[model samples]
Each structure stands twice: as structure tokens, then as C-alpha cells.
Target: MAGLFATLAIRKALDKLSSILPAISLLASSSSAAAMVRQGHEQDLEDLRMLERTMHRIHATLKDAEQHWDIRDESAKLRLKGAQGASV
Candidate 1:
């Protein structure tokens, strides 16, 4: 029963995370696109380009973090199973 509760909690947390992930991604994508649309001279353009790169980097970092969480969650499930097996 405790194990079931723990699994439910983990799944709930992951579901919340999954819901927010797309909003974050869309925000990043839209911001990047907006930066590209803004007018600028050579120097300004360079700066905007840098901003775009930074935004992309941030997006990529978020993606990596989400992937890491997924890996951790999967590992947790495997560990939980192993623990249950031992108990049985």
C-alpha cells in the first residue's frame, strides 16, 4: 500500500512536470522567433543573434533537464521493482 502510494505520488509529480514542459518550450521558441523579428543594424543584429543563441541554449538546457528527469524516474521505477522483488 505504501509502495502504491509512493508510485502514485511520483506519477503525479511527473504528470505536473509534463504539463509545464510544453509551455516552457513554447515560450522559448516564441521568444527566439520574436528576437529574430526585431529590427537592428550590424551591431544590433549581432547582439540579437547572440540573444537568439542564448535562448536556444536555454531551451536545449531545459530539454536536457527534462530528459534527465525522465531517466531518473525510470531508474526509480526499476529500483522500486527490485525492492518489491526482494520483499516478495
Candidate 2:
């Protein structure tokens, strides 16, 4: 169904987001902001702020997905294959 595909797309996006979050978080802290300012990298600080906002939005989407998503074996395997291909 259309709804299922949309759910799958959201799941795929979340998987991608999850994989990248740690790297983003490492660069998004208050200390990191201060370092960027001291180094005169205002753009980098702004980028970190953007990443934090993006992560918050994704987290909210994830909560919604948890409530509404239907996980079936077939779809899960498909998502796994897609992730594996992306890693290559």
C-alpha cells in the first residue's frame, strides 16, 4: 500500500540519520561551538546548529514512526539490503 511505502521511506531515512548522528553530535557540542568560535569558524558553528535542529526533527519523526509503523519480515529484509548496498 502507499502508506507502507511511505513508512519504509521514513525508516530508510531514519537509518541513515542514525548512522550519521554520532559524528554530528561529536561536532555539535557547546565545547565544539566554543572551539569553532575561537578558531574564527562561524560557518562551522552555524552548521553544527543546523545539524542539531535536523537531529531533533528526525527524533520527533522517529517517535511518530514507532507509534504507527508496521514492521514485516519482507520489508525489513528489503531495507537491510538497501542499507547494505549503501555501505558499498
Candidate 3:
């Protein structure tokens, strides 16, 4: 799931970059073109950073869930063993 999110984020960034490309060409000789490119690059970097943070959070959540699941399984097994012993 985190991989899926990361892939989607990359696709979105690429889409944004493609859209910006034509505009950059239109203003190729203008000083503002450099500024625009710089700003766009900075925005993309920020977006990627945000995506990385989000992925980290998602990974942590998944790890926590898996740990809880393991604990639950162990508890269930112990209960089952105790119940069988009592029956015997």
C-alpha cells in the first residue's frame, strides 16, 4: 500500500512537470523563466518530502498493526491450550 502511494505520488509529480514544460519553453528567454523553474523544482521537492513523511507514517501504522496481530494470535493460542487442558 505504501508502495502504491509512492508510485501515485511520483506519477502526479511527473504529470505536473510535463504540464510545466510547455510553459517553460514559452518563456525560455525571460528572466522569470529561471525563477519559475526554480520555484517549480522547489515545490516538487517539498511534495516529495511530504510524500516520504506520509509513507513513513503508513509504514509505522502497518508495523504496529502487524505486532498487535501477532500478540492477538499468541493470546488466542494460549487460551486454546488452557481450555483444552481444562477439558482433559
Candidate 4:
């Protein structure tokens, strides 16, 4: 469930990145594009930076969640084993 949401969020972020890629490519191919970036693309650049930070945070959070889930899963398995042994 957590993984599902994380995957969805990552996909959304990737979609956002795809939208930004053409502008980035333009910068590489055209001096006019470079000038446009210098003159009017500050907001787009800021958005990219913000998305980068969001992705970093998401990655860190997903790592923590995975560790927690692993611990919880192990604990649940042990509890189930203990219950079965008592019943027997």
C-alpha cells in the first residue's frame, strides 16, 4: 500500500519531469532558447528545483517506510508462530 502510493507519486513526478525536458533540450540546441531561459524561465527553473527536493524527500521517506514495514512484518510472523504453538 505504501509502496503503491510511493510509486504513484514517483510516476507523477516523472510526468512533471517529462514536461520540462523539451525546454531543457531547447536550451542545448538554440541560443534563442538560452536567452528565453535567461529572461523568462526563472519560474520553470525554480519548479524543477522544487521537484528535485520533493523527490529527494520522497526517496528518503520511502526508505524509512520500507525498514519499518520489514520490522513489522517480522514481528507479525513471530506473533503468528507463537499463537500457533500455544494452540497446539
Best by TM-score: 4
What is the C-alpha local distance difference test score of candidate 4?
0.57
Per-residue accuracy of model 4 over 56-81 as CA lDDT, tens digit each: 56656554554554535767546434
Clashes of each: 0, 0, 0, 0
TM agreement with the true structure for every prediction: 0.37, 0.39, 0.43, 0.44
CA lDDT for candidate 2 = 0.53
**1-88: candidate 1 lDDT, tens digit per residue:** 4355444444554456556555655555555444544332334545545555544444444344444444347675565555434332
lDDT ranking from best candidate downward? 4, 2, 3, 1
Overall local distance difference test of candidate 3: 0.50
- lDDT, residue 34, candidate 2: 62
How many clashes in candidate 3? Answer: 0
lDDT of each: 0.48, 0.53, 0.50, 0.57
Cα lDDT for residue 27, model 1? 55
Question: What TM value does model 2 have?
Answer: 0.39
Worst window of 10 by summed lDDT in candidate 3: 79-88
- lDDT of each residue in 5-86, candidate 2, tens digit only: 5446655765776577666555555344466464554456566566556655644554454455554666855654453344
Q: Using TM-score as the measure, name the better of candidate 1 and candidate 4.
A: 4
lDDT (tens digit, per residue) of candidate 3 on 1-88: 3333433454455466556655654444343557777677667656755655555554454444434534347675464344333322
**What lDDT is reached at residue 30 by model 3?**
49
